[model samples]
Target: MIPSVILLEKGASTIHADVGEILFHEDSMALFYYQVLNGRVRLSNFLSDGREVLHNVICANEGFGEVAILDNGLNTVTAIADSSCTLLKISSKKFFEIMHEYGHLHHVISQKIARELHFKLFMIKLIYNRSPEEILSNLIHKLNESKRLVCQECNRLMLTRQQLANMTGLRVETIIRTMKQMEKDDKLNIVRGKVFVPADGID
Candidate 1:
């Protein structure tokens, strides 16, 4: 299980935000490091053409918005609450102070940052693909590996077809059609409007 904010919560302040609330904007000063105590946070960047590319979806017990602090530079991406969220906010200076006391906190942060980098790089390659079925399958597998969602019957994917479309840059119509095809192929199953990978899992 991923570590929650305990050691790092030393001088942190808890804040509640509603869905779609912006925690910080790109190019803004990164004064704080944030951890999600509940709900999800989306890290994304807007293109010059007005397209938004989602970089990461950080869930409960995950920490984010630390890159700018480490570099002493502006934020590279905007953070928005994907759902009504509980967040722990700690000043950059104080965050370091706590890290010094709890050395293992540094390891946890490093591992998470590395995983985020790997996920984004994988998505960059997956996003340019033209095959709908292949893209969707790869995306499902990736999400499972990233621990963003589990694949068991009791814990099926919570993402809607539209949400899958946004992640893959596909249209919702395409997502629905592709899902139907995948379902018919026994690659996935949909019950009560929730999507699930097959019992044998994605192979």
Candidate 2:
């Protein structure tokens, strides 16, 4: 993520979003580059059947909605506030200027996009005919590997069981059942109804 000083110097503004607020809809023109200063954002697509497919969760210090700006295209996914959030945003023109002025930012952005691609590819491979446990384990592993875990110290997951179901195209019940079994098998832990993975990650 670009430094706040840089973004503010380039005319960035801070915005507060309430939980469940829609920042932008799919196919909307990508007018700004957004970075979370606090809280979380969900990036997802709604299917024709009205089912949501989660693309990614943007946590504090992470940027979202950049691909569209970089590609000069419309947003491919809708961005919603997963929790009350403070975000910094700069117009696309100013963002481009910042990127041009700071060449190293390009590398940072490229790495983020590559991680997203890797996650998508991994999900596509695991979501088909994979066991619930396998899917969940891999998903957790990938999230941890990508530094997306909400609590890095305890390796707490960012998504709820329902969100996991949405991301993996599984049922909520299945996600819960599988996670319970995973805990029993020592693959993960559920304490007081909240889930946590190993700090070192699942095997």
Best by lDDT: 2
Per-residue accuracy of model 1 over 9-103 as CA lDDT, tens digit each: 46678899999999999999989988888899988887898767666777888788777898899999989899999988888888777778778
The 0-to-1 C-alpha lDDT of every candidate, in the order given, reads 0.80, 0.90
Measured against the true structure, the TM-scores of the candidates, in listed sequence, are: 0.88, 0.95
Q: To one decimal, what is the Cα RMSD in angstroms of model 2 from the true structure?
A: 1.3
RMSD after CA superposition, every candidate: 2.3, 1.3
Q: Which ten contiguous residues of candidate 2 have the minimum total lDDT?
A: 146-155
Please, what are the lDDT tens digits per residue for candidate 2 over residues 1-203? Answer: 89999999999999999999999999999999999999999999999999999878889999987899989999999999999999999999999999899999999999989988988898899899569888888888877876775578777887898899889999999998898889988989898889999767888
